[model samples]
Target: MAEQNRTSVAELVLEGLSERAEVKAALFVLLLLIYTLTLLGNMGIIVVIWGDPQLHTSMYFFLGSLSMVDICFSSVTAPRTLVNFLLERKTISFTGCMGQAFFYTVFVTTGCFLLAVMAYDWYVAICNPLLYSSVMTHRLCIWLVVGSYIGGVLNSIIQVTFIIRLPFRSSNVINHFFCDVPLLLALSCASTYINSMILFSMAGVIELSTISTILISYIFICFAMLRIRSSEGRQKAFSTCVSHLTAVTMLRRTTIFIYLRPSSSYSPNTDKVVSIFYTLVIPMLNPLIYSLRNQEVKSALRRTAERITVRL
Candidate 1:
């Protein structure tokens, strides 16, 4: 621990991406391009979904929620990184740091659970097409999304509780972009055993349970596909899972990388680099993945554009 814990944290220094100015400048330009692309891509998803009414199905509903979350998730961290690139003073208040940590956790966790629900949705849709309409009713969809939000809030509360209990007498500098649990815990001056335990337990529950459920659902889907006699049927069924799988794999893999580590081994620098995936890249990739791959979305976009062009 540092000798003196000051009453006022005059400045929250960034022990930035190394001491070399050249490296920082390079990171700046690269991240700025990614940040801009993230915003535009996610915004495009929301716009395209909103403009098209046929996309009001449960799947698209989930897709819209995902876009909204990705937007919020990216906003929570990217702006700070962009600002750090340009600003002379690279500091965030203690309260602000906590705020970013809270929201980031909320959105990311919610997105994770929601993605699991999406996998299950695909399962129900393909495995039981006859019953899909009944099983995935408006009420059921609402409940599933609500459940995701509830679960995320509880998860965030547990993580945030761990963060609040830790003593920060050692260092005020939070390396990387935002306040994340693993990194923040590393800086704490207290015994973070309890917090680390809770974090691990939560990760096991959220990540393991969700991933297991999705995997099982896909297993059943695959089995059902195998039984189908027609080649077209198998291809069509597998296509349904592809986009969801892409999104889930992108998020779950990276989250496991970041959260599954011990506090002692947590690296703020590495966290920042990978954090860009979930925070910026995945969100942008999702809409594009779903939209471009699906004929319906592309056709809808074309028709919508045609209508506008005709009116003009």
Candidate 2:
């Protein structure tokens, strides 16, 4: 009976961001612009890093990997969202909904690990300059990236497996623009205590672990900076960290707010607003934050642009 109930719903309806005609029109244009910029900005970062020999270092390699992940992360939701704005009845098949949730979890989890690894990279580079080269070798960087993706896959499989087992026999309507685990869990007819516990516990663990890594790395980075006598030297060291700190704070806060609590406490309106920020806004901002703040990235962009112009 439970299995039959689960398979009964062939399609789920998405109650997207807005319903009004004017609002949908405005959102379509605004979201289209943001999505375009996200692709262009992230893709630019990857291309610049790949083409420039000067950026052939551990730091830029991680930045490139991050850019690629951001592209995937935003792509998982943004395109569907744009399409839904045009359609009167915004709907997704059961399989498509689950697929979105799966990939969304994978990229988001991978992104968190990447940020944590990047924090550690900064720690090594700033705290142990002499050993940075030896410590963060190309082989080690590649393994770190591969491990992040693997961890994401494992986590996603577990979470989605739990969701798949539940019989969503009540409402086929999801409150947000995209399919999220918490929202999906809310739609199930069966008692979601186990599912909620798993979601909260896993989210808590991931958040606690990753945030701790970032905090500890920054603490060490702070001490290392203070050890430098000159104010100019200290400032230079601190500047490199600003971009990463901004990105981490934004991503962590939004994710924790959404996932670390019981689904009963969820406010549909508030969740939609926050989801838009992290899903659409943050990916758009990351490359801009990194490139605008980093002089090395700026120089590399200029070099890449000049080479392109020459070819043209």
Candidate 3:
């Protein structure tokens, strides 16, 4: 820990949140409940999907991937933030902040890529129905997942590199709950033009491009829906897209709100509010948005329950 910071610094003090005893206790309770909810919701999605062999298709496979990502994404910040809220000192050392930023970078980037892949999967399924099975076969699905991981790694490397190289000279009170890219960069005494450029470029490629792909895919889906003669098919198709649309909306809104500015011009207060949405609320909502309204998931759960009851 000491080795990570400058040699002149003797002790790394954590400058956390307020000193009010009541406020700290309240925050701890609220955040602890949210954190628990996040874990249960995401893990439940993964468990149900894995347990239901009927969900072994590409769609559910990606859904399981999404659930895993949500779990990791929320876990990266919420637990630590909850701990910080409970403790008297909320401050994280230089290394700890950097490490948090690093994992956050990885999971966040993975989410961006994963959403794009899911969009592509839907595009293939709807746009080319005859070839859907062949196109989205096990091999292709594996490749898409691999692409997501690769994109996440590459993006995280870029963001972390810029953040790591910057010099932070005192007044290290990060207004937010966690060590986000912009908040950390704001502490740098030196100019952050290089870092800002890298952050913007990375955000542009990963966030913007992925979102655009989702919109375009949905546009085509909409067109196809208009042409469907069967009412049942239309309703089912629309329902399939509704979940994807909801998830995409949540991800994109929070992402754009947070990363749409240069670090030099970012507001920590705005960042903190939006960060809570994406980092905490959004992860908790993923399973509900995707699984709650889906009849297949509900049916599978019932079947599993009866099977367990009979065995017992």
Best candidate, lDDT: 2
Per-residue accuracy of model 3 over 1-312 as CA lDDT, tens digit each: 542453222223444444678877886786678778888988877888888899888988998898898888889888887777667666677777777888888888888888888888877777788988988999888888888888887877788777766656566666777887776777777688888788878888887688888888888888878888999888877888888888888888878778875445566556666777888888888888887668888787788778889999
User: Could you arrange the candidates by TM-score from highest to lowest?
Assistant: 2, 3, 1
**Local accuracy of candidate 1 as per-residue lDDT tens digits, 105-173:** 889998998888888988887789899888999899989888888888888888987677666766887
Give the residue spans of candidate 1 off by over 4 A.
Answer: 1-11, 18-22
Question: What is the overall TM-score of model 3 with all chains considered together?
Answer: 0.91
Query: What is the TM-score (0 to 1) of candidate 1?
Result: 0.91
Output the better candidate (1/2) by TM-score. 2
Shift of residue 228 alpha carbon in model 1, Å: 3.3
Instruction: Identify the leading candidate in terms of TM-score.
Output: 2
**TM-score of each candidate structure, all chains considered together:** 0.91, 0.97, 0.91
Tell me the deviation in Å of residue 208 in model 3. 2.4
Clashes, model 1: 0
Candidate 2 lDDT? 0.92
Better of 1 and 3 by TM-score: 3
Per-residue lDDT, model 2, residue 98, is 95
Comparing candidate 1 with candidate 2, which one achieves the higher lDDT? 2
